[model samples]
Each structure stands twice: as structure tokens, then as C-alpha cells.
Target: MIVTVQPTGISAADVLAVARGDARVELSPATVEAMAASRAIVDDIESSGRPVYGVSTGFGALANTSIAPQRRAELQHALIRSHAAGIGAPMPREVVRAMMLLRVRSLAMGRSGVRPVLAQGLVDLLNHEITPWVPEHGSLGASGDLAPLAHCAIVLLGEGWVLGKDGARMSAAEALHGAGLRPLDLAAKEGLALINGTDGMLGMLLLAIEDAAHLFAMADVTAALAIEAMLGSERPFLPELHSIRPHPGQAASAANIHRLLQDSAIMDSHRDDLAHAVQDAYSMRCAPQVAGAARDTLEFVSLVSSRELVSVVDNPVVLTDGRVESTGNFHGAPLGFAADYLAIAAAEVGAIAERRVDRLLDVTRSRNLPPFLSPDAGVNSGLMIAQYTAAGIVAENRRLASPASVDSLPTSGMQEDHVSMGWAATKKLRTVLDNLTSLLAVELLAGVRGLQLRSPLAPSPAGRAAVAAVEPFAGTPGPDLFLAPVLEQARAVVAGRALRGEIEAAVGPLS
Candidate 1:
């Protein structure tokens, strides 16, 4: 089914469906008429023969340069050609698709003065699974992700390369012909309209936000399994304990942990402090505080994305009264700051999770599980290197979590100085989220194996179910085996692609 584009609204889920999932998108009837209305205004400006910023005059430092009506069409092509200067490896295909989807959504708002065919061309490219060969670099993330979006725009004109489904690069013209569509002859201001929004950074943020939401839930699940496996008390996660501080995310995480560990004989076995340490390490003791902080950050970022989804982020937006006025709505400062904050939170989540995995490996720290959770510590190395791998990823997250938004370089001959670098923020945020899921999965795998080692002491029903949910991916636990594959299996579970539904089946909706 198609996701109908509306003027005032679009949701993150809707973007994900069209961008990542195989959902087609099109302009609603009202949006089609709206585009016609906005396009007519641009035609009037063109016939008047006066220079408008992006409509007839040059861009950025060259804004004072004027073009005659005969050369106006050439001006649009030149704008796209010069700005399609991105260099680096190609960005992930999913992000490119999302960027395309969002660009069309922005156009569908009818403020950019683009014709319907321009929007339809983007939809056609997406529907045909033809992704523009968008480079990973470029985009100071202000002036609307110019470099990256230009790569996308170039494909619309049949002038650049595109990625086919078979992972081969083909000419944009070939891709368009195969998809039964034609290249756009960009109308006035349409070139600036294509590359002049926050879509590139905004698209990455939407997917990262979605990924973060799932992994944050997995954090609670893994933290619960870690708590029971380590013989930690649930008193710290008590609803009454959280009510005093009253951070909604904290309360929610604590409640989930407490509920998942319910009816556990392992927890019951240590109810009176019969054998285990009186307290857990900070990684175990402070699960909710760290994870909950990340959860709250996720919520904040989502709110920002939700606002951006419905916004008219174009520069020189066309008002209802036919006034085209330059505006700074194209600035990416909001998204830059939000993505940076979430990256910090995500890195911490990984850091703490890695500590827990290390603790589970250390016999002295594991509260009497075998060394590295291996029964034969000398003969079998167990997950010692697996913990190392998680630690390495955690360290990388630390490196990546440094705020990209804080760093700016002057561009457009200093006419556009002090960029948000939001594209950089969202790019690294994706990496941090990836590392976070792996870190949590390492902890979950070790925690579950440790739980199995405590044979006579049964886990809570939900805990057992979590273990069962990952059982296929995690494989039958034994002495040392190929640990990388085992962790990869568990990572899928923690990433919520595999076990979330089954675990939620046994427990309930998480977060």
C-alpha cells in the first residue's frame, strides 16, 4: 500500500515504511493541487524577469549574479551539477532511500515551488528500488545538506549514477528508463528546492531513533537477565524506589526489570543474602539510571524528529500571499544537538553493558560463576575474546560519541560559516546504536549462559523465555566454540529483529 503524503503531517513510522520497507508513496490530490499553486507563483516570477535568490539569480556567494530568462533553465542544472560534489564511500542504501522519501515529502508540502513530476520522479526511483549513489561525506548540514542531496538530485535529472538492486552501479538515465520514468527538466527554483532541506541528516536521525527505541527495550531485557544471573537483588528496581526520583524513563525501566525478574528461584535463592555479594557492581546496580537516561534522550530526539517531519524546511519559502522570503529554517542546529545528546547516551549504554560482560567473565567478579563462565577455565577460553570484542566496540562508541555539532568549518566563502554538522552527528549516531546493540547482546549471551550454569536455581518465567528466545541464535551453550557467530546470533536478538516478539510474547509489551 502507498503512504499518502499530506501537507501538514507525516509520521516517523510512515517514513520508515516507504524508506526501508517496500511501501510505495505518492502525493495526495490536495498536495498535487498545492504544488500546481506554488509552481504558478514561480512561473509568474520567471515571466516578471526579476532576479529571485534561487529562482533566477546565482546561489550563495554568487547571489548577486543575474541570469536572463533564456539562461534560467541552465541556472537550475548548474546549481545541481556544482553542488553534487560529495566524495567518500556510498552511504548505506537505507539512509539514501529515506533521504529521497523525505525530499519528496518536503516537496509535497508545496512550499518549494516544484512541479508534481519532480516529486513523482523521486517516488518512482524509490518504488523501483533504484538508490542514488549518495556519498557518505559532504554536507556541513546547513544550507540544507547541499552536497549529499545534490547527489540525489543528480539522479532525478538522469545525469549521475544510481545503485541497482543487484548492487551494480548504472547510469541514472538507464535506471530511469528501466523503471519506466523520465528524467526531470528542472523548472525555476526546483534545483534549489531539491537539495535545500535537512533531509539527509533528518533521515538518518529517524532511522537511528527507531533503532535506539528497540535497543533501549533490549537493554532492559538484558539488564534483567544480567541481574538474575548475577544474583543481584531486585530491591533497587522497586517501583517505590523509583517513585521518589520519578524520572518517567527510570520508572519505566525499573518496572520492566522488576517485572521480568518476578517469580525467579535464582533471585529467591539469594533473597536472604545466603551466598552472593551484598551489592552488585555499578553496571548491574545502576542499570535503570544509565539505560533510562538513554531512553529519555531517545524520547527527546523523537519529539524533535516529529516536529521536523511536519515542517517546511526550505530556504526562501513561498508564503500564501506569493511572497518568497529567505528564512533560516534550513539550519540543522536542532537535529545536530539532539543527535549528539543521543550519541552520548548510547555510548554510555554500551560502556556500562561492556562492564557487565567483563564482570560476568571474571570469576572473582561474577559472584561464583566459573571463570569466563567456562566450567573448564584452563582448557576452554569461553567468551574471554567476546568480552574483548564488546569492549573494543564500546571504546569506539566513546570515540564516536564526541559531539559533531560542536565542530564547524566555514563554507560558501564564509557567507555560510558556523554549520551545525548535523549530518556528521546522525552518521556517527548510527554507529553508536550499532555498537550499543552488540554490547547489550554480549551481556545477554553471557548472562544467559551463567543462568544456565545455576542449574537447580530456575530463572523467572520471563527470564527463561528470554533465554529460550535467543536459544536458536545463541546455539546450545558449551565449552569454547566459535564465539563470534554465537554473539552475532545474540546481537540479532538484542537488536530486536529476532527475539523481541517472542520475549514480549512471554512477558508483554516492552517500553
Candidate 2:
């Protein structure tokens, strides 16, 4: 399918499509008109021989320095070459693609005064899969991801390197030549326009935020399964209980939990026969509060991401009235704070999930199930070690949860006196997500085991569908077996493969 860029909006799903190499870009007519208008203003500025920041003068600490018109092309080329200093491992292909798409979107907004041909070059690169080999590190996420973006921009001039389809690194010239493409020329602010934006950091954060949202939902579903497996009360999720102090996320989470457990014969049979009449432990009972808080965090992150995606986060924006205005929209503090918050919320999910895994493995807390849910206690360690792994991840998540946005270091001779460090936070959030996925998987495995012990009484339709999805991949617990594959399958289920159809079928349709 062809994905068009509209000034009205962009979606996370569209970004994913571009990353996956399905690129058919259509620029909005309004955006094209805006680009043409901005270019005219830039031409007038050049004709009048007036100096502009990053256009006729040097950048950042060297902004006071002037470049003569005779050396303008050399100046722009040198700006790209000298600033392409990103170091560390190459970023994933998807991140590179996202960076390209975001830059294209920003340029298409027509506030950066880039030429149409230069903007189209980015689209052409996306279409032909000629992705630049951008590195993971080097952006302080201030000054608009200058260094990392320079790496991306250099490819347009056929100066840097690009990754080939066969996983080989080739010079941009070779890649373009092999694909029947020609190198581009930077006219006026084209180089600065390409390299002066928050696209790099924003792209990474967008993907991270999207993943965090999915995991947030999965965290709630997994916690619900654990609640039933431990024979915990559903009273905590009652609408009446949450309505008095209604946080929308909390209320919505309660509703979702009630829906997930609606048809559980295990819950019904246990509620009637179990000796305890009051409520379950906080880990099982307050699952909504913990998971709902994460969902709320995602809600705020989504708002921030949506705004950043549409914003013209570049310096020296060209006004519609043909005026050039220098600004600091490039500052990444907003995104940095959002990424840190996301990490903290994701860590909480892991924290509570670890506790549920602990409950399932404990003899006293497991409600008459064998210790560690093992058939034979001594011969089989059962899920004992899995709980330990989950605990270890939870501890690590606590450390990773430290807010990266809270810390800052001076750079650019203190010209960039405050750094966002948001990229650092986003990177750590990805790690937190990895640990959370594994931790949730462990809890799912334990919950399924506990559910098996309660059988004869059927699980809820959602729970049964979840169990069936993993059953094909899970083996009966035995001595000293590897659990990685089982964890992977469980993760796939939580990520929308296993119970997705059943859940959607019941819920009708998802927005």
C-alpha cells in the first residue's frame, strides 16, 4: 500500500510501514506549496546578500564566522563531512528508515527552506532501500541531533556510506550509482535543513513509545492471568470499587480485567469453594493500579510523540510571510522527559510482574499448589529458577529506571549548556522493554502451570485462547529443560499473535 504524507497527521503504523521497506510517499499539496513558498524566500535572501545563521555563516560556536558566496557549496559540503562523526555500532535498519522518513516529513512541512529535489531525494532513498549507515550513539539530543543527522545527510551528497541489501557497507556513491541514482546538490539552506532537526531522537523515541504501549497492554493481560491462576478475587477489579476515585486508565483497566475473566469457570469454582472470602494479595488485587499507571504514562507519551512528529523542530524556520526566524524548537527536553517517564512506567510493569511470578512459585502463596508449581518438589525445580530470573530483571529495571532527563552535561563549549540526554533515556527504555518482555513471559509460563493444576474448571475464553497459543510451543515440565523457546512463544502471544483474534472477536473491533 502507498503511504502518503499529509500535513494533517501521521500514524505510528505508517512509520512502521516505512521502516519495513514498503515506501510509496505522497507529499500533500499544501506541503508542496509551502515548500515552494519557503524556497522563494530563501532565494530572495540570497539575492539581497543578507547573512543568515547556518545559511551564509558557520554553525553553533562558529556562527560568527562568515562564508563567502564563492565558497558556499564547499562550506555546505564541509559542514556535512565534518559533522558526520557518529560513532558506535550501526543502528538497526528500522531506526535508519524511521530517521529518513521523519526528516522527509519535517522537510515536507516546508518550514526549513529545503529544495523540492533535495526532499525528493530522501523519498527516493526510502523507495530504493538505500539507507544510510547511521550509528546508535553520538547525539546528546541537543542542537537537534546534529552529529547523527549529519551522518544521514552526508549520504544525499554521496559522501558517506550506506548498507547494501546483502549486508555489506558501500560508499553512498557506489550505492546510488548501482541503483541508477545521482548525487544531490545543496542549495541555500538545504544542508542545514536536512541536518538541523530532532528527527533522529524523535524517531527512536517514537518506535520505543509504540513498543512500550503494546507491552503496557500485554502487562495487564498477563497480570490478569496470574490473578486467576493464584485464585485471587476479582472484587478489586469491580467498577464500583474504582468508580469513586476514577482515574480513566484505572477504570479502563478494571473493565479490561473484568472482560478477560468474564467466562472463567476456574474463578467461579474457586470463589464458591475457597476458604478465603475477602480479597487476594496486593500483587493480584492491585494489578489494575500498577498496570493502569503504565497505560496512563503511555497516554501522555503518545501526546508528546504526536506533537513532535508534526512539529517543525529545526532552527531558522522560514515563515510564510517570507521572513526567516531563528528558533530553538530543536531542543529535545520534551522528548527526553517523555522517554524517561516511559522507562519508569515500564519498570513498574516488570516490578509487579516479578511479584506475581514470586507468588506463583511460593508454596504458601500458591493456594495449595505444589511448591514452585512442580509435580514433584525435590526432583523438579519447576519454575523456581524462572522466578529468580524475573526477580533479577526487576532489580536491573530499577537501576535502568533512573531518569536520564534529570542529568545533563555541557557540550559545544557550553553553548549547548544543557543537554536533554533523552536519547539515553530512550535507549535504556528499549532495554527495560527487553527485560519486561522476558519477565512477563516467565509469569505467563508460571500462570499457565498453575492454571493446569486448577483444570476440570475451564479458564476464561481469553485465558483459554492465550493458553492454547502457547501450548503448541510449551512442553510438559520436566527436569532441566531449556525455557527460552517457551518464553519466546509466550512473548509472541502477548505481542498480539496468540489471543489477538479471540480478543478482537469478542471486543468487536479495535480503534
Candidate 3:
């Protein structure tokens, strides 16, 4: 599919598609016209004989300094070279692609006073799969992902490192040549426009939101499996009960759980049986409430991502009129808050899932299941340590969930004080999301084991399919083996592969 970046708007799904390398990006003619018009304003400003913030003057603390016309090109080049100061590991290729796509989307709006060719350079990189080696750190995510994006912008200037179109180490010049493109000689205001935007953080947030949607749904699917394995009731998920709360996420989660738990012999047998307690543990009883909150967080972050997709974020953006103005539209507090909030909610989902795994393993609490789901109870140690792994990840998430946006530090000689450390928040969020998947997978593996032990009493339709989806790799449980391979496979299934789809097929699309 082709994703057309217009002057007016773009979609979250389109961004995801570009990130995943599933779609091509086309810059609309209107976007090209807009860029030309905006560039005209910058050209006029440069000729006006007055120093503008980014066009003629130096950046940040150096704003008062002006460059001679002969050295203005050098100034743009120097800005990119100096600001490409990021350290540590390179960003993943998909993240780079997403960020590049968003940067192009912003430029297409023509509010950044950059030329059409500059935006096409970004689109061309995506088209040919030439990913710049962007560092994961260095951006405060205000003044809009400056350092990270400079690393990307320098690639377009053919002065930075990139994995070439063929995915081998190469210089940016070599890569762009192969893509039938040239290194740009950046014009006035062009360099600042290239490097100034929320693309880096916002791109990751968009992809994370997409991943979280699937993981959030799987949270419910796996939670149902755990509940059924432990013979917990689904009465808490009744529409009558959820209708009172009316939170969209809570209601949706309840409906999914209710669908997954429908027509269960285990639940039916325990519904009236006095052996079971009046209710299950909060982990089991309130799965919807917890996972639902995460779902809601995902929704809010999506809203932010969508709004950001359409916004022109930069310092000294070009106005629709002939005026050029400096503004704080580049601030990342909105994205920072969303990313941090999501980490907290996603961590809780993992936390609750870990608790359920603990319950399924402890004989006293598991009701009838063997300790650790061990076949021999004393020697096998089946999945006992896996629970520990899950616990550790959940515990780590508690710290990662602490808001990074609240902590501020001055930069650029205190001219840019009270900065938002959103990049740190988002970088940590990536880890939390990965850990959440693994935590849920351990619960899934344990729950399936418990269900197998139940014998003659099979799971509900959705639960049966959910188990079937992973059982091929997780295997029928037994004594100790190299369980890591199996656990990783189960993690893949729960993180979003075949299991959820199998369950949806059986129960009809899980709400």
C-alpha cells in the first residue's frame, strides 16, 4: 500500500505501516507546493538583512551571533555535524523509518520552511530502505528530538553513517547514490527544519501503541486462560456488572473475558459448587479492571500520536502568512506524559499476570494443582523459576514506571531550563513493553499446564484454541528439559502471533 503524506493529515495506522516496511510513502503535489511556498518565505527572510533565529543567526545560546552569507551554508552543515552528538546503541531500523516518515509528514505541512527536495530525501530513504544509524539517547525530546534527528538529517547531507540499501555498512553518500539521490546543500532555515520535530519520540510512541493494542488484547486472552486453569468464575465479567462502570476499556475487557470464558465446563461445575470460595483473587477477579486501564492508556496515547502526526513541530516555524515566528510547539510533554502513563499501566498488567502465575503454582492457593506445576512435585521444578523471572521483570517495571517528565534539568547554558526528559521515559517504556509480553507468556505457559492436568474437563472454546495455538511449541508438560526455548516460543505466541487469532476464531473476535 502507498501512504500519501498530505499537507493536512496522516493516520496512526499509516505511520505503523511505514514503520513496518509494509507501505510506500508518496509526497502529494499539494505538499510539494506547500514546501515551495514556505521555502519562499525563508528565502525572503534571509534577504531582509535582519538576523532570524535559525536562518541567519546561530542556534540556542549562539542565537545573537550572525553568519556572513558566504559562510551560511557552512553554518547549516556545522549545526548538523555538532548536533549529531548522540551516543550509545543505534536505534532499531523500524524506529528510524517511523521517525523519518513522521519528519517528512511534518515537512509536508510546509510550516517548517524547508524545500520539497528535503522532504523527498526523507521519503526516498524509506522507499529504498536506507536506514540512518540514529542513536537511542541524546534527545531531551524537547527542542524536538534534536540530537537524534540531526543524526538522521546528516545522513541526507551525505555526512553520516547508515546501513545502505543492501543492509551493509556504508557511508551515507554511497547509500544515497545507490538510491539515485544526491546529498543536499541545505538552504537557509532548511537544516533547523530537518532536525527540529517530535518525530523520534512520537514515532516510537506510535509503534508502541500498535504493539500495546495487540499485547493488551492478549492480556485478556491469557488472563482468561489462567482463570480457567485455576477454575475461577467469570461472573465478574458479566455485562450487567460492567455496564455500571461504563469505562470503554473496562467494558471491552469484560466482554473479551466473558466471551473467552463462555460455555466452560470448569466454570459451570464451579458456579454452584460450595468448594470454591465466594470469589477469586483480585488478580483473577479484576483482570478486566487492570488490563482495561492499560487499554485506555493505549487509547489516549493513540490520540496524542494522531494529533502529533498532523502537527508541525519545530522552533521558528514558518507561518501561513509571509511571517516567520518562533514558538514552543516543539515541546514533548504531551508525548512524555502519554509514554510514562502507559509504562505504569502496562507494568501493572504484568504485575497482575505474575500474581496469577504465583497463584497457579502454589498448591495451597492453586487449590488442586501441583506445586510449581511440577510433574513430580520434588525433583522436576517445572516452571517454578520461570515465575521468578516474571516476578523480577514485574519488579523492575515498578521503577521504570516512575515518570521521567517530572525530572527537569537546564541545557544550552540555562536558556532551555526545565527540560522534559521524555526520551528517557520512552526508551524505558520500550523495555517495559517487552517485559510485559514475557511476563504474560509465563502465565500463559503455566495456565496451559494447569489446564492439561485437569484432564477430562476441557477448556472453553476460546481457551481450548488459545492452548492449541501454543501447545505445538510449548509441548505437553513433563520433567525438566531446556525450557528456555519453549518459554520463548510461548512468549512469541502471547506477544502476538497465532494464539490470540486462534482464540478469536473460536470465540468470534474477542470483543
Each prediction's RMSD to truth? 1.4, 1.9, 1.4
Q: Return the TM-score for candidate 1, rounded to 2 decimals.
A: 0.97
Off by over 4 Å in 2: 7-9, 166-168, 478-480, 506-511
- As a TM-score, model 3 comes out at 0.98
The Cα error of candidate 2 at residue 338, in Å, is 0.9
- Write model 3 residue lDDT over 232-264, tens digit each, in one string: 988899989988998999999999998898888
TM-score: which is higher, 1 or 2? 1
Give all TM-scores, in the order shown.
0.97, 0.95, 0.98
Residues 194-293, model 1: lDDT tens digits: 9999999999999999999888888888888877888888888888888999888888888888888888999898798656567677888799999888
Find the 10 residues in a row with the least total lDDT in model 2.
502-511
Q: What is the C-alpha lDDT of each candidate?
A: 0.86, 0.80, 0.87
lDDT of 1 at 196: 94
Q: Candidate 3: where are CA atoms >4 Å away?
A: 164-169
